[model samples]
Target: MARLVAVTAVLGLLLAGCVDPHTWPEDQDDIVNGPLEVRTHWQAFTLEQPLQINDEGRQRLHLVLDGEQYESNDLHDPKDYVNQFNPRRVDGVLIEPDIILVGDNGNEVRVHGTGSLGVRTGRLILAFGTHHGDFEDFLSRPPAIPDDIEHFEALRIRSNEPFTIEALHWSVDRHPDLHRCGRRCTWLERWLMGE
Candidate 1:
């Protein structure tokens, strides 16, 4: 259908924006209110719980995610992480830089977290899909906590080339010391990740 074709064309354009976390932006606010395609990459949190970030009344890009929860609607056990998050409202504002977290090479106040985020450029596209988890199954393997088994600092503004500290699906849930054990992990990751 022509409608489907138009949608595909629009999506192709937005995705081509190179909305990676490392893509530095001159104005961070632009990202705070860009298209869902771009904005969704900026921040993600549930209304039941939000990261209240502040710093001496100054403004900075608040890259924050609540500490892992042991039990909740999204999670029933400590072993359970966010199974599949949906960012109904992805938004943020440019605030003051984090003083405690700074880079050794410089002092730009490095910030990182496992959340959705994107560079604020020019765009207008919204894609709906799973926002988190799909890897909590690893917790059942023992010694595989959410923190260690997962890492996704979408926007750190790091001095290094690899500004973001994101881990691939495989790296996050390393294969157990067994045969074909990674099958479920791989399938789950791909499914929830829209792959």
Candidate 2:
């Protein structure tokens, strides 16, 4: 009976168009819908402090970027840096906000920035471009973010230039039983399916 059941399960998976015998149905589906940016060079930094939960149950923190501290072609000052997160959502799933621009001048400090939660690692990448007058187009776009990271805490902008601000993320282990079929299973399925 055990061997017969195993054969039937393999046949069912094959009929569902499972190309690789090891590829589960859930592997073919992407539940998180968001535009992810890939990056190669970024410096890792430890979280300055542990995450604090707010009354709303959302986590929060602050990342500060001081551009003036870095050597740059232009005179880096704190007021020159500015950024924005364009927020959007689909079917109640919150999409990752876009970091429109990060500049050294003609921009205001944003109270919040983009980030990902449950990430084990975090990074900082520098964007290209020099400072141009507000009338001219010279502000640099936000650096690319890794696909797996999500969650943004607060942003604290001061008089600085050429600095990257990033939030901490926690990496979580994938749940073994939470798949397409849902959470709970019958005793027979649990016993025979090994999940």
Question: Residue by residue across 57-78, what tens digits does model 2's lDDT show?
Answer: 1122212212232122112222
Give the clash count for each candidate.
9, 19
Q: What's the lDDT for residue 51 in model 1?
A: 18
lDDT against true structure, model 2: 0.26
- Per-residue lDDT, model 2, residue 118, is 18
RMSD of each: 20.0, 20.2
Q: Would you list the C-alpha lDDT of every candidate in the order shown?
A: 0.25, 0.26
- Model 1: residue 40 alpha-carbon error in angstroms: 13
Off by over 4 Å in 2: 1-43, 55-59, 67-195
lDDT of 1 by residue, 128-155 (tens): 1112245435223322122221222233
